[model samples]
Target: MEEESWQSITVMEDKNGEPHVLQQKVKVYTSGVSEESPGYTKPLMKHRIVPVKDIVNL
Candidate 1:
């Protein structure tokens, strides 16, 4: 198989074990920045390459 033609799907599961389609998102991280930087803040959440869409309101 050619790397360019390879594809895959990822399904996220909720706390109830329900599956959901993952969504694409861009996130900006402030890790390793100096504390004096305007964007500096504690790393609250870990970043993932693919993030799941919010389904709480569904």
Candidate 2:
């Protein structure tokens, strides 16, 4: 089965020129004999959205 883990993220940006997390999804899989193959358990997901209030020039 596939190992349960979090997805790696370096940087995330939104359409309003803001950094945020929206509709985060993760895949949970059942254990298998090998790492190559794994079974899915269910579709687990989440959602979030944020807007930039101000922009600062650096």
lDDT of each: 0.39, 0.48
Candidate 1 lDDT at 18 equals 64
**Every model's TM-score:** 0.26, 0.33
Candidate maximizing lDDT: 2
Candidate 1 collision pairs? none
Against the true structure, candidate 2 reaches a TM-score of: 0.33
| Backbone clashes, each candidate | 0, 3
Q: What's the TM for model 1?
A: 0.26
Model 1 CA lDDT for position 2: 10
Model 2 lDDT-worst window of ten: 48-57
- What's the CA error at residue 6 for candidate 1, in Å? 18
Q: Give every collision pair in model 2.
A: 1-30, 1-31, 1-32
Question: Given candidate 1, what's the lDDT at residue 43?
Answer: 28
Q: Summarize candidate 1's per-residue lDDT along 1-58 as a digit string, tens digits.
A: 1111111235777677766655433233343455344432232233333323443454
